[model samples]
Target: MALDIIAALVYGIITIIGGIIGYINASSNISLVSASICGLLLIFAAFARLQGQTWGLTLAAIVTAVLLVVFAFRLAKTRKFMPAGLMTILGMLTLAVMIHQFMALRR
Candidate 1:
């Protein structure tokens, strides 16, 4: 749970930073708008997890886990060791945390 919260917070912060950068550098409004939305959603998801919304967190974790697995596998097959390893570790950690939370909620 702590790990999930921390990861979400980190992700939110990164997204918000990216959004600010996009707004400053991009002439088109669409990129900035999309970044802002992404930032907001990341923050909202973080807060939801903090509040013990197991269902939402589980869904998000599952999707992210699948994406991470696919990314890792592709990278590994291409011999991109660093990124592949990092993604695999991150995906497994997130999946484990979310699954634990989900099981606890079910009980």
Candidate 2:
């Protein structure tokens, strides 16, 4: 749980940083728009997680899973454990949330 929280914070910070850099260096409107949206989403998600809401956790887990799947494959050649571990945990959390949500819906 602590690792997940730290990872979420790091991811949010990096997203905001990248968005600012893109806004400053990007020449096209589309690029700026996309970066801004991404940055805002990251910030919002971070705050939501901090609030300890289930929805926030779900969103964070989903994002983490996608990131892990995309980057883990490239990093797998280096035999790194961080990405793989994060992915596995995130996937489990997401699955748990989905199941809970489904059960609630059925009720």
Candidate 3:
């Protein structure tokens, strides 16, 4: 699979798992629902990207960016290096990879 696909998949899986964890640990339905939606969007984007669709990368970038910002805020508010911090870091890396892949796609 392409690096873009891999990155998206990894990020999606991680997000989904985090949601599941949140649901299990704290019964946060919002977290589970939001993460599931975001993760599924990423997964769908991966398939679209596999078919050479620009919108796929665009969607992936947007979703990742949103998640990154949310996590960053959560991290800042909590000042704890745990779920929020970890997610923020992952989101940053995933978004970076998606951006690089998008540039390559343009070229």
Candidate 4:
């Protein structure tokens, strides 16, 4: 659980940084806004998990799943490994940890 929470926070920070970088490089307001919201939500989820709330990890898992798919699509389209591919891989690991933690919490 602690590990998951930490992973969630790290992932969130990475996402937020990615968004800022994306905006800086491409000037995409959409990317900045969306990523900021998503990253904040993940950070909030980590806090909730720290409070022993199962929904927190569940939220993290859902968000990670969504982002994983989106990044996967971006990777497929761009064939790039720096942002999209990297994020996709990170999201997979984060989601897996979140799911495992949630299941253990439920049991």
Clashing residue pairs in candidate 2, if any? Answer: none
Selected candidate, larger lDDT, 2 vs 4: 4
Alpha-carbon local distance difference test for all models: 0.61, 0.54, 0.90, 0.92
RMSD of each: 5.0, 7.3, 0.9, 1.0
lDDT of 2 by residue, 1-107 (tens): 33444555566565455446646676556545644554455456657756766566567656655654654673666566544455445445544554465365458
Candidate 4's residue-wise lDDT over 55-75, tens digit each?
Answer: 888888888899999999999
Q: Which stretches of candidate 1 lie over 4 Å from their true place?
A: 1-3, 11-43
What TM-score would candidate 1 get against the native? 0.58
Q: What is the Cα-based TM-score of model 2?
A: 0.47
Error of 2 at 2 (Å): 2.9
Score candidate 4 by lDDT.
Answer: 0.92
Candidate 3 C-alpha lDDT tens digits along 5-89: 8888889989999999999999999999999999999999988988978798889889999999999999999998879999999
At residue 5, candidate 2 shows an lDDT of 47
Pairs clashing within candidate 4:
none
